[model samples]
Target: MRERAVQRQDRLLSLVRRRGSARVTDLADQLGVSPVTVRRDVEALTGRGLLDRVHGSVSWPRRRDRPGGGRGPDAEDLVLGLLAPSATYYFADVIRGAHEAAAPAGARLVLRICDYRPAEDPARAAGLLAAGAEGLLVAPGWRGPGDQAAYSDWIAELPVPVVLLERSVPPGGPLAGLDRVCSDHTHGVLLALRHLTGQGHAAPLLVARADSPTALAVREGYAAALRALGVRGPRPVIGSVPADRDPEGFERAVQELRSAVSSGAATAALVHNDVDAIRMVQRLAELGVRVPRDLALVAYDDEVAALADTPLTAVAPPKREVGRQAARLLLERLRERAEGAGGGGTDRGMGGGAGVVPAAGAGSVPDADPAAEPAPRRHVTLLPTLRVRASCGAGAGTGGGATG
Candidate 1:
């Protein structure tokens, strides 16, 4: 901990030890902190069994007090449980949006980082439900190759509603009844292709994640975009490169991308995810192949895409809006379930008024009264916008010329 923080904490403990208890205002006056800060310190110290909070005052932990505390089920105000593999990148904005929407909707959106599972993935939703989460907002769990279930069946067995976030639901796939909110990644591929081809770059290589749930949709969209544009050439889709946590794999992928552009296998490429695109852009820079000058590039997700050395042209999923919509969608369901339950929401004690869901969804004012027209359904497929920048060779002066 920082020295100042330790000093403040120490001062707090010392005061409690000396006086038996100290009022929050008195500690704040002595410690150069606000009463709120003193109270927060008291709370933390109490959590560690270093002190006890005694009605606006703090005292040394009593013999009756045991820290590293316990929370009964009733203490859990967790209404919606959100789980995603990584905390940063694409999901951060999603989480932010979820929180923003959940507050007005009167729901507490609890977050859990889905960590690496040794034998099997954790019961991501069940544990949340056990902790009194009313519903779940989970990015579809990563499964093995060819294990094709869009929204898993096991989630159906769980008693709560499941809303898949930022993941695809295959057409004619299972879970017709499931609620999901995702950016149309396939449409993003088409957008990138059209942008590149419109600028006279024919047969650009498409890089993608082979083992991902969204890969099939991306590949299908690439081919469809190629055919729809009537562009004729040996269209290449490279899936040998991976999108994983390993830096080595990303570096190898970068080398592979560099080789493709350097050897003239493809002058331009559209990579599905931005992390690989950033690494590839750095590698290409190292190889003295300038983006938009030697190799035109486009990334699917815009997260950190613009931060590339060349400021990559990318198709960015509206992630925050997706998150906002996901929350609204879940709340809409909760609302309907409320109506179905004779207007008293199932978890009456949970959200009170904070979880009051807006009827017209995230971006609009309600048209028909929520009671009149049907509450908005939960499934939402948000479209992506193509961000034209230096890397794709489609912005301003770069638009007319692609090195091929």
Candidate 2:
């Protein structure tokens, strides 16, 4: 219901912005809502200065370009475009963080949702550009390596500055030199393993999917993290699908973990995403196996981990911070371009904001040279921390640190 309300309000704002002003009755009819509801929404928007409520109508405030306008007094009106796969679930917080950062900067964030239409991404970005977007923050839905290869060329050729949000390209790819902000999944896997190992459990088995980039990262990171921790055991990783999409595949994953636990071959496990983890715990419970008793468990993504019956101790990637930093970087790039200085600087390592180190293997941050002017591109990596809970035999404790 809350999501629906947000969508409706977004539509209302877009309509008023495009039309300049709209009668309350007309807005109600166009939005498929009652006049009372439209007036209530208008009142809320007016309070925020997003709309000016006149007699029986609402207008996009004219003072938008002046001091004490809807924007900050010292800020120039900046328009940014955000293109993402979906607005709900994990991307919801990402979008919220971008908005929170953009508001104080007096920037208007325009969003484009591309669902089940990977081929339309370039076209959608063009539309955002045509709508007067000065820059773009894009999260392309690249299902595999092939998808990246197919989309990287045009994405690199976009006219405005672009920031890859929670996405990265392989080193030497067309967009490899572009600015990107992503959570270091390798560090996230390390935190999950260290926490489980500190609790006297051997290397936990991994159950993850290969359909998405983050899933692939978790699967590969699990092995690397295990080796780094110097904990050696039967390190078997299984595959899983969304519980609703492929029940049989999910059941096979659960049975694999069950076999490992029942035979005392494994004592702890990590699941890629929270939804799959929660469903696994529920199914395991029905089979007479309990979390933190029969098998200690950790889940990744931390999206809804805490809501599980036995709250899950999960690795929470710095998702919101990634969005914030990515937007800030793009804004900075735009400011530099506006100031007549080309986008180049003394290897401004990630330290300018958060403890963002350059992402290893994804791309290289050029070494600072005293003779040369400065290096322009940056690939920032944020670290994820572990949230302890009942599922991992820890009682509501924050156990992991950001530093690896």
Q: Of the candidates shown, which would achieve the greatest TM-score relative to the real structure?
A: 2
Candidate 2 lDDT over 1-404, as tens digits, reads: 44365456767877887888899999999999999989888887677556788899888767554443223222555678898888887788888888878878888788888772568787677656644466788888776646777765777677677788887677655676678899899899999888888778878898898877788789889889999999884756888998899999999999988888899999999998999999999999988889988998999999999999999988898888988998888777666555434224422222121122355722334563434322356789999988888898873233433233
Candidate 2 off by > 4 Å: 1-76, 343-375, 395-404
Quality of model 1 by C-alpha lDDT? 0.65
Which candidate tops lDDT? 2
The regions of model 1 sitting more than 4 angstroms off are: 1-78, 116-122, 147-151, 171-174, 240-256, 263-265, 341-378, 397-404
The lDDT for every candidate, in the order shown, is 0.65, 0.77
Candidate 2 lDDT: 0.77
All candidates: TM-score? 0.67, 0.75
lDDT by residue for model 1 (1-404), tens? 34355447756766666677788999999988888888887787677555678777777544422244222212223267787755787678889999898886556776666542312223555445433356678775464444435335554454555677876655434443456898877678777877777676767888777655555667778887778778764545666355456667667666777787777777778887787787777767887878888888988778888887778888877889988988777766555554453123332212222222455555223563445333433468888888888887646544432221
Clashing residue pair totals per candidate (backbone < 3 A): 6, 0
